[model samples]
Target chain A: MGITDETLKRRLDGFRKRMRDKEIDMALLVEPDNQYYVSGFRAISYSRPIICLVYLNSLQFILPELEKDHASQSARTDELYVYHEIACHRGKDTQFHRPLEHLLDRQPASSTIGVEVDTLPAALYCMLHERNFIVKDMGPDLMEMRMKKDQEEIHWIKQAGVLSDLALESSLHHVQPGISELELDSFGDKKLLEAASQQFPDQLIGFADWTCSGITRSFMPHLASSTRKLEKNDVVVHSRQVWVNHYRAENERTFLIGRPSNEQKYCLELAIEAQAQAMQVVKPGVCAKDIDLAAYHVFEKHGYGEHVQHRTGHGLGLTEHEEPYLRFDNELQLEEGMVYTIEPGIYVPGVGGFRHSDTVIVTNNGFESVTQYPRSLEDMIL
Target chain B: MGITDETLKRRLDGFRKRMRDKEIDMALLVEPDNQYYVSGFRAISYSRPIICLVYLNSLQFILPELEKDHASQSARTDELYVYHEIACHRGKDTQFHRPLEHLLDRQPASSTIGVEVDTLPAALYCMLHERNFIVKDMGPDLMEMRMKKDQEEIHWIKQAGVLSDLALESSLHHVQPGISELELDSFGDKKLLEAASQQFPDQLIGFADWTCSGITRSFMPHLASSTRKLEKNDVVVHSRQVWVNHYRAENERTFLIGRPSNEQKYCLELAIEAQAQAMQVVKPGVCAKDIDLAAYHVFEKHGYGEHVQHRTGHGLGLTEHEEPYLRFDNELQLEEGMVYTIEPGIYVPGVGGFRHSDTVIVTNNGFESVTQYPRSLEDMIL
Candidate 1:
């Protein structure tokens, strides 16, 4: 209910417009991100399969009976078909195919359908193909449409950035010589949730602000969390994610407990310089790879090129990671309202990691840094 | 390394045995749960895709470069393939398909391959079949093999149940007039995490204990949480999920803020009785649907059949919800070591809701309750 129905309607209309131009008659959206983007129906869909079928003039959200209450509560489009109920499908010995067919039968049956081939389950794809419908990949087009953020989406995403900053700040306040990474994580999350609740009383934002501490585990990027306690000269990575009205953003910083060694200070400042260089040129029409290159160039200039491991960053919105990715393989142009995380890290095996991640929004002539946090080497030294 | 390699090896042998019986030469596991079950490689795979290709003779874990470090550190299987490296695929382009082929090429070139058709992306599925490999659904076989819980899995799941109980208990202590639901949620999570940190300091489990409070919002079963204060005579349904080494379990209880009205007390006791009845019959060789019927029968006897919106409950393991769901259509028999949740909920329009969910495992003769939370109305009433 937080996101306006008008906004959701506009999104659906955008997809339908692309469908018509591509000569596609129907579209089936199965990815939870797409479902949430289109209809505001968000549910834990890791193992369970939920289907959202969209026709030229109608839409049906297919889910299990167990999920009905939640689905009905959140979904903007309310035409729901039960996965367990044969009566809902209204066909002989009904299964997924029957319900899908039943929904399609009421439509014009234009034969051409758009499916999320990139994310939809394989069995469902084969079933539809066997039923003889012309199928096309909706991934490219859907991604293209989703890259540019609307004002409503931007508002939610910016709020997520704010919450992430709150968590990062909380992490900084809690970091000490004897503190366990898990302890900081739980306390930081609680602080973020409390801050978010104070801001939006009616909503709850999802969070994953796990700590990656010490040298070895910190070197291994994407470490969820560890039980290792922070010690003097240890690098504590506080990578945080906060979801506001389903829009998510990433904000992180590397803290040096107590003090930094000469190498640690050099790596920390080098990472900040790399992040700044990437942020400086993040304007409309700039190549995504160029931002990544700028970060890599900093490490090379500093003679720490071997320590550089990942791309500068990737995009964020409804999901933590999305389009407009900053990588070497792709040459995609950044556009206004396109948001991405600009995290450039240098992780040395035995010396711990140094990095700071911030959500950045590409504006007309410059970039708007949504995540505002101190990144100087002196400021980050605990 | 959370679960022992010996356990992972046994699990691999189990899957390989199934593959041999089905004559599936190569199995491509893309589901995160399947990957974790086989190789102990756990990652947040809601959006990111990780591939685990199991050959007759060897196993290869394919992941993106960013994920390589953590994947290598935890995965028991040694063979690792980097998706970005052209050397790994040995072709012009290095995409997801090429590395998949690189692994498949090492095998005896069997025409038939097993893939998780139920969960694998549609485009990947079509591409494999188009490449002339007769792709068959491994979902059924994999599920059958996963239905019976191993000792390692059960141990982790039991720990999750314990954390849930701790969290629920913590929530009970904080529930009082003027206390907001979000605050209780944060406090409860902190308590659970603090306890976990002390026991398994190296691990930080994922959590999402959604709350449905008040009258109208509580009527909407999928309500995540609100900042609304827990006033006197309010109904609060706390549905929690705690993860232990990626194995998940649910332990939920509907609580009264101050005291329940006559109607509320009647409904609460009815739901508890329904849950108890379902739990009573959860023994080896018992039909799953009959267990669901036990709960539904109770609701019908109390003339609250229409108020009963959902099935008894679903299974829980790697994910919070999985297979062996207790529903009328399903005729699958319960077996020893198979774990599931037994939750029977009743929701009236204006009167609010009542339900208690417990993680239960089918035992040799009877049933074992992994979740040991108090279900009595007086005990839960603040």
Candidate 2:
């Protein structure tokens, strides 16, 4: 099942309370995840703009005509204003701006409007400014609200994590010296899709994977899976994120293929230790920085401090990387129901990058890991 | 091979010329495709802001610490300023805006800056505005440049088209009753990845597929593939896009699973005719509206004018949908080397959606079809 109507109602009520506190007459949401949180509608692509407007009492959607039926079925909204592209509908709303302008005209000229400052387009912001409307950033409010996952969201994320582990197992089982990175990812894709189909009929599921192999490619963290064949003794960083009903879980593992170097084994073990340390610090009321620092100290103690490049981990939910990051600078307190990935990594120049990522949920006192894939150095060697 | 250095130089020179003509001191590119076109660099994920600044004589990148090595190897830039998240790197450029501000401080207060108004975040735009600098839109300039594919770009797009066709054929081969939509997509994915790995070694290849099976889901044009099993007499619209080295080609086919209704067959044939009519009108110097209208007339003559919801097609290249769309209101003239997807579809309330998409390249006089998947009613009947 998708998100419950009761959960959606509670979320909308909370957002309206926030808007009232800020004395905002309207909140224009352009970020897809934020919109999906309030209204249960999402499109595969957003090359054509889709707007969600929330007021004190009701919500509205301004989308393309192509999404009319889909939004009507999924979105719990008060009104939908569709803009058409077909010639026969020329006399109607042909452009999104036309309907948007009409909606704005209905509101008071001096009304305060809230917008996602980080995602709202400059052109739209300029239009609101030129119209003499008071605009404030509601992006932070939405981020703060979405940081804590509800029970329904957690359920899907847990399912995604379980599915991810299965997919990772299938991919590793097919790992060999001659297989290309893309082919390696494909093996997992087939297993994940087939398993998801069998288990969760009628549910929407999606995934993204990145396999960076060899010393040169794996040293850089974020590279797409390519057609380069994996060589003997190559260190490969395989990252997979699976989303069930839009909630995501990230799972990553660094494995050694025919490795002979003692340094490579040491680095992989260090990464596993760092990830464990970070996961150990995940508890309610703990500072986000503490987790990062805990993992950082592991690498620093091993004389690999400079090799650490990114944060320990990032929050995972509707989007790939959400707010409340486990970074050294972040001081946000961990709360119950908050979900994040415990992934701390180090990349050495001549050696290879090593990291193990697992999704975990913060419970009343401690944290519970959703992904249970084997990540020990012995298990990682292929 | 990836993008050649000569192509990068030519693209940069063209963009700089546009900036010089506008008297803009610098152009800040935030869109991933635009950045890739100019700098030949792209990150797998951009949750952390990646800013590319192009000046009259030089190019600079301000990115997260994780992307330092990746960007260095790929981006053709003069300088790289990285912002860190780890605590040890504090007091250095800790946030993206800090480095961005440092770069801005070097320019004169009255210096003009160019930005992608359609995609630049409102917060960034406000920051630029508060700095007492004049900002102009360079998004259109980038779109205009990207509209006409270069020879090297076309080569990759062709490769993408070939891969897309092969993938579609694989999916269609596995189409049968009781198979889930996602399972259908996975079959194609497996075939595509294996073939791409064999054919294009050491290259980057990616794909996205959406299979909207049955009446209700098919009525909506854009929906992610689900785990809903196909039933007898189901109407399925299978859409796939394959990208090689960042260039994309879209391929789609609407097929019948078992014994479809006569109305379904007629609708499918009408969609095929509409697409053919639109593709036939794709010549240099022709207006974009003419192609859309040519497709629209096919449905109108067949008494399904009101059923059309979206435009005939959209430009396809680095982005899924780009400028110079095939819409009735858009009167932009088509040019040689322009690539577009000719997909003219109609969705009936009680029936289903019918559309066949093919990527085509505008030639000196006519057009060349890149995605040549079979579209006949007989060929589509599974």
Give the number of the best model, judged by DockQ: 2
True-vs-predicted CA distance for residue B76, candidate 2, Å: 0.7
What CAPRI class is candidate 1?
A: medium
lDDT of 2 by residue, B1-382 (tens): 5678998999999999999999999999999889999999998655799999999999999999999998888899999999999988987988899989989988898999999999999999998999999999999999999999999999999999999999999999998899899999998999999999999999999999999999999999999999999999999999999999989999999999778999999999999999988888889999999999999999999999999988988898999999669999898999999999899999998899999999999999999999998899999898
Candidate 2 segments whose C-alpha is farther than 4 A from its true place: none
The ten-residue window of minimal lDDT in model 2 chain B covers B39-48
Model 2: DockQ vs. true structure: 0.88
What does candidate 2 score on TM?
0.99
Give me the candidate number with maximum lDDT: 2
Model 2 residue B360 CA deviation in Å: 0.2
Estimate the TM-score of every prediction: 0.95, 0.99
lDDT of 2 by residue, A156-244 (tens): 99999999999999999999999999999998999999999999999999999999999999999999999999999999999998999
Per-residue C-alpha lDDT of model 1 across residues A260-317, encoded as one tens digit per residue: 7788888888999999998988999899988988888888877787677667888888
Instruction: Please list the residue runs of candidate 1 whose C-alpha ends up more than 4 Å from where it truly belongs after superposition.
Output: A45-48, A66-74, A85-97, A104-110, B45-48, B85-94, B104-110
